[model samples]
Target: MSKELLMKVLNHEDTNGQLPWIPFAGVHAGKLKGYTGKEILTDSAKLIECLREVYRLYQPDGMPIVFDLQIEAEILGCELLWADYNPPSVVSHLFDKEKGIPCKCKFPTAESGRIPIVLEAMRVMKEEVGDQTALYGLICGPLTLASHLRGSEFFKDVNKNPDYVVQLTSFCAEYAQKMADLYIEAGMDVIAVVDPLVSQISPKSFSKLLHEPFKAVFDYIRMKGVKSSFFVCGNASYQIKVMCETYPDSMAVDENVDMVAAKVITDQYNIALSGNIPLTTTMLFGTQQDNMKGVLDLIDSIDNKKNLIISPGCDMPYDVPPENTVACAMAVHRPDEVRSMIANYSSSGFDDIEITIPDYASRDKVYIELFTLDPEQCAACTYMVKSVTDIYDEIKDMADYVVYKYFIKEDIARTAKMGLKNLPTMCIDGESVYISIIPDSDELITEVTKRYNKKHDK
Candidate 1:
């Protein structure tokens, strides 16, 4: 069946409508408008403007209003280190910093931190696009939100002190219900409960710790007469069958789980299944042709229209090129267009070109190799390159320094030779010390200084 017909069946609408393609645009929307993830989320105007641009480009059937999971934790006093290419990861957990997990967790009001910003954005989006599009209000699920508040301790709490963990998760559930109510009032059509961390726990643990809170949140959303979806990212294959029993209107899984397998499980429960496409590998790193083919492969694999919703496996990378996402959306809406694109598609290195790094040992000066796929297009690569460049500027004159930026696509051999596992890595004198995470500037300086001093001593 066609994507449009499939979407209609999933939405419980007439068969004449087209399939609903919802791309989890998340932090990528921030990059589209030249704002960092933190800036885009914390400011209502920026978030609205960014999402409007996303709507114009993707023409999605449904779109998430706000995708930041840190809103609740930020309001609860957890510190975050914002990224230009990704949603800010929770850096400091409040419960960890405080003496202990509070007996009673207080729910955050709309006036708290970024909550007002998200709500305002939702309201504006509803007024502007509600007629044509289904607006999704994304909230971190109780288990995941509790994890953010208490850190890994929450996981241990589940293993060690089950009763207290249950209380904490219940508190998070109440907060989610309140947030869902607020979003329903703002005209959201769907409330998505995203608890990716649940994948880490065993099914027994999930049942004991999350089942009640999960049911409460979904039940509350249903009571309010709004639709609900549960989104989980990571290796959730083990929990897919059990997750279906939660009775969400829809369940979204990431690339780690097989869609064909998920369809069978979700079908048993008669729940809608969305996703399993590799966002990082196919959408973020792969070409438009790659995305089109990948999505088509997934669509062809699923059996029933009522049991499927085509989408990215998880939230898109912040710097994923807009063209790729637009291509994926178009492919989902118009399979004929996808067929045409695939027929004429050529395997050209348009974006995946590589760069060559000169041998620093052969040269007299110190060498700084900034290995990247494409700093201009890749957010993580851009920051990694910048962090090294900034450090270079601080100590360039002090040493005979040479900085070269290498793109992996153009120089696969160099990348492999360096034994680099992640993109946007830094190499000093052919030794790779920094991996995926951004290294501290002072640390980089110290390492560079040591390298220079060691060379002089030799």
Candidate 2:
């Protein structure tokens, strides 16, 4: 029938047993082109080029315009801590910590920071590949946006201040709908409400505080005659039934939720199912042979892929080897070849991947090890390493630190040895203090002093 890839998978009417594969690589595509996160995200031409490269490489049935959840948060006054390989992480919430209240902020508009960049990128991408492949307009889900704006306080507020959270969530949903309108106009065929935080709360809490707001977002997308999907990565098994009932055309979950089990749940509801490829262990670090094995395993686990879209569990890390992703696509399109490769493939050994934990009590000065993926390419690592430097003048007497450069690409052995899961991890006295998140200067200093004081007190 030569139907569009996404629609074929969404309806599952007759793909002729050809399961659609979607690779969740967005800004990470910039890495393949030697462009850093900052350069590509800021320049629409570069961003479009990155997307084009991804389309040419992976040839996904559907692809997200952006894998970043920080765009809407950025427009709403939440400051992002930018990185080289991955999307920016929200650092400063739009709330007054001292006052313990939500800070007043202006609503974001089309002219807001980077919204135009995103919308422009989508328009440009559609002109290039819209008719052939499904272009996804990714938006931050309401609870996630609220969390970005209000920080963890948003979670606490759900309990202590349900009314306040209800109001904030409503605003986020409306904001998402506005972005949805812009995306639909820009030629996006799908609206994915990406909300990873939803996994942290209970079903009861979700039903009480979040269900209606989320339902509204899906309802709005339906009114636009576009597909709406709820993307909740993490173990969100409890909400699968609720999500199917929430009115989204489909639901995508991460590897934490078993795809086979998820399929069983979604099957009963008759909604579409997608996602489950492991990002780090199998996708980023695994070899092509491993890729085939993992893909085959995922394919076997699902009862049926009729309405299922095979995809990575989460955003493919910025440095995920291109070959691994290509292998995944190969597993889908060239299964005979993959079967042959799997027959000859041998397992890799990591028997020596271990680093001795430092004894903080034995050291005179507190030791901090900052693991990074090339400061030359990664702004997040650059700033994180600098976070220590800026305070070194004051804490030098109490602490010492070192940096592991190109930690993901060149130093895979060391990365594995450190047991580091996220980039720019801050290890203090052999204990990881922060993963991906750059702690505030004051907070970092206080911990340093406290460690020093503990040494003297003993």
Candidate 3:
């Protein structure tokens, strides 16, 4: 019943007016079974255990086999920094502007890196849950894969060296197609190009650089007779129309994009819509009542439930209370029952969680604080942090820099105290300077320098 209903929604068909649900479990699945992300992601047995626990607890209509985007990068020769909670981050790149991409750098085969491990897990999960659940095979998007191979220089090359950027992203698109083929062979019901970085660029940049690569990979997936989805995180509302032009079977945006507004563009192309559940404020920090209310509210906001799949904005965090997710599942499955269960729900009661912000005027050095949803796991947060890291050496003498991860309960409280409205924001002297967008090195240095000079009265 779950698989059939999910396929109907993914296929943009009538699901008897029932909206499907897919929680991007990812590494968070490991937490349910008492396994660390590093332990479960590497060991098939542990990964399976965690996934089974998720199925038992959440009863998701669809779920990804593995959500780590670093798999392809690790295979392609990038060094990774592993974590116990979050997915690994690429610590080293294959190439940069100073050193061009090596001739030896080529596409990965099915046997490369951890593909065998992931494929083995995928095959088994298909047999374990495929009868009732839709298994999603998530492949890294071209822009993100390019960032892995070329480091942060990939973003700067958009303006400096367009031709080189094209060549690299073209190669990445080919890699994505091959990955889709492997996932299809392993019996994946859907192939999602999980490219969170798409939210950072402008619509014009996407049209000029990424349009063809995205279209090519999605076209390949469609030809293979597999349902496809374009999954993006951060605030991607601005480029929703351009993203639709690529023509995926469905489009999933995170909590940042308005679902009502996004549904209009996706519906224009007859594509199904999924997501916009707040991961931090609601899922991680908010109570179970808040989670139930969120799911119910999202369901109420959408008049057309024909092509909607209720889900979190992005991947669920490591310690997002299982009861909260259970609450979400109950709301999605039995909205009326859950609605009565939490009719008078209020998100208050955090009044006692005190957070004292720093005094900007009294500080001798210019202060720069980066607020993120853990850069290690989030593509947008990774580059936004790198934007500051790229210029840190020059500003070290005059500016004090720190990163505040929203995953921590303390940081979540700090967000409310500091009046932060967005994740992965850069604040200078307690003021939000850059929102979701990553600033270029030159501009970052200039801003820090101006602040430092003002503080010194020079």
Off by over 4 Å in 1: 1-18, 97-105, 344-458
**Local accuracy of candidate 3 as per-residue lDDT tens digits, 1-458:** 29888899887788777878888898999989889999988998888888888888889899888999999898888899999999999988888546365343467677888888788888998998898999999999998998888887777787778888778888889999989999999999999999988888789988998899999999999999999999998878888999999999999988778899889778878999999788987898889999999889998998888889998989899989999999898989888899899977787835677788888999988999999888888988999998878777888998888899877778888977888766778899988888777777777888988988988888
Per-candidate TM equals: 0.74, 0.78, 0.95
Model 2 collision count: 0
All candidates: CA RMSD in angstroms?
8.3, 5.7, 1.8
Show where candidate 3 strays beyond 4 Å.
Answer: 97-99, 102-105
Q: In model 2, what is the error at residue 5, expressed in angstroms?
A: 3.2
Tens digit per residue, CA lDDT, model 2, 103-163: 3355556687887888888988888787778888888898878877776555457667788
Clashing pairs in 1: 3-19, 4-18, 4-19, 353-409, 353-410, 354-409, 354-410, 354-411, 366-400
For candidate 2, the 10 contiguous residues with the lowest summed lDDT are: 96-105
Model 1 agreement with the true structure over 88-185: per-residue lDDT tens digits: 76667778534255434456667767778888999999898787878889998998778777765554577677887888788889888878877888
Cα error of candidate 2 at position 39, Å: 1.1
